[model samples]
Target: MLEPPDADRLYAALLARDPAFDGRAWVGVATTGIFCRLTCPARKPRPENCRWFADPRAAQQAGFRPCRRCDPLAGAADGTPDAAAGGQGLARRLMAMIRADPSRRWSEADLAGLGLDPSTVRRAFRRQFGQSFLQMARGERLRESLRTLSGDRDLIEAQLDAGFDSASGFRAAFARLFGHPPHLMRGPADLAADWIDTPLGGMIAIADDAALHLLEFTDRKALPEGLRRLSALCGGRIGLGRRAVTDQLETQLDAFFAGRQPRFSVPLRLHGTGFQRRVWQQLQTIPAGQTRSYAGLAAEIGQPSATRAVARANATNRLALVVPCHRVIGADGSLTGYAGGLWRKRRLIEAERAYAG
Candidate 1:
């Protein structure tokens, strides 16, 4: 057990339901004889009725049962706040449902039918994965349709399988994800694109049998352009599927997110200028849990004056965790720009704390 802040400050945090205080403090209510997280949505207790504990164990030891409303004990293992755990748990359940029936079109009504609040589901998915649950379901449907199209099946069949009533609608949805209509992407392909689910979000991995060419979050703004570049590089030979490289990458990612130092041995087909390649190579050399400034990275690449150029290269990196672009920070140690979104960057850095030497 640890000491909490002054009672007034603790009460203020409980009132505000501050996420920063999550896992760092637990509050017991005297009237109710229950303990809850500070960020619990339950009604706040009066200051006089509130008792602060630094850890859940302390609160429980003080003759307070865990509050069922907040389920404070649920987060004791990893110290995840109840609200965040709720979002992530909801997102996972939805993702599993989407995967089980990739062709089903999900909507607000469907979510409601499953006893989920539409707006709450929307916020949960967006916060956990940076996209709405509906959008993720739609993308899964599109990927299913893409597989059908690439199998040399009729385009009409593919469109119908996507749960779209019309070809135009299916084409539009497909183009939004891949930067190309279904017709254009169909055919024998040398590079395969596959979906990978991470704790943070869904990512699309593109690879040949030998090496991974790109791995990006599905919601990344640069993903479509990256796909276009890949298409051009592979002479328009890209389709929906996975190769051994993708499987290997997935395993490595599993280890990484599980708090182990992953040895990323999957061969990479880096597409960049010489200077950019040097910067990426230097990035891989950065130990997990350590960050480097653009100037520091530039100096490591023997071009100390190319800090801006280094930053640009970092932004353009197509291989997300494999290249560790999230390890690069601003000169003042700010997160700076990450193509994968700043929220994910922050999460990755926090996750890697276990790997710090």
Candidate 2:
């Protein structure tokens, strides 16, 4: 179990009954031997008697029972009426059915046949997942195809199994998402994309058995272009599914955010030009909470005149925090271009500084 840092901040959130920390943290009270959500209505405990945990399971493992006042086990306190809950409950049931057999095409008529109002179902799912039911089904189908492609199956076989009627149709859909056709894939042909939810936001991680190929925030503008370049380098074999490296990355990210781990041990598959590879290697050599200039990095690479080139390579880096591009500030110590945004860069640098101290 990972323990979050900044006890004072978490205690402040508890005192204010902040709902933002509900699912991300739990408070275990020593006097009552019970764990409650940060938004729990019960009286706040003394700072010395309060023990913060990352999740409810951690609290339970530490021998604390759930507080009867606030059912932390049942998600956040929405306070929705029973009628709304009942509709969402049906939507959940329908989602489960689709997940059970993602290869099967589900339609609005299908929901109506099950005694559900299609429009109501659509709204409920959209409100919860930020996507309509049909879009979710399409995503599931793509995931199924990716799972099949990870095996020894041929493209045609994988496409048909994913409920696509024609190879051309499947190729178009795959290209739209990954920026390449299924046939151009290289490497192990078992690449998978995993969505990871963090305190900052949602991130997408792509990996194969050997190493992590890509890790970027979902909202990054250059994400599609990066995917295309990675596919071209790997001979176009990217897919959607989790591998050993992805699982390890998820755990390491959790630890890193919790201030429990300072460095990542998950192997990376660095696909880039020879010069870019050298620059990234040098980036890894940078210590946490430190900054370097492009000229310094270029000099370190034995090409002091290649400062502009080094900055270009840094901008092209897709591995966000892992590659430490945020550490490479301007020569004047001004924060410069970062694909994940300068605000995020500032936050990362500050977090590292705090952790180091």
Go through the candidates in order and give the C-alpha RMSD of each one to the true structure.
6.9, 9.3
Candidate 2 lDDT by residue in tens digits, 62-147: 99998999876553234333122423454567778887998987888987897666776675565444457887787678767777
**lDDT score for residue 15 of model 1:** 90
Indicate which candidate wins on lDDT: 1
The most accurate candidate by TM-score is 1
lDDT score at residue 6, model 2, on the 0-100 scale: 70
Local accuracy by lDDT, each model: 0.80, 0.76
Candidate 1 clashes between residue pairs 3 or more apart in a chain or in different chains: none
Q: Give me the runs in candidate 1 sitting further than 4 Å from their true place.
A: 1-88, 150-152
Cα lDDT for residue 297, candidate 2: 98
lDDT of 1 by residue, 1-357 (tens): 012345776787799886645555789999999999898999988899998886666776789998888787652354444333545566777888899999997889997897667887776676566678888888788778756775767889888987887888988877777888867765568998888878777788999998999999888888889999889988889977779998999998888777664448789999999888998889999988799999999999889999999999999999999999999998887678788888677667766765774
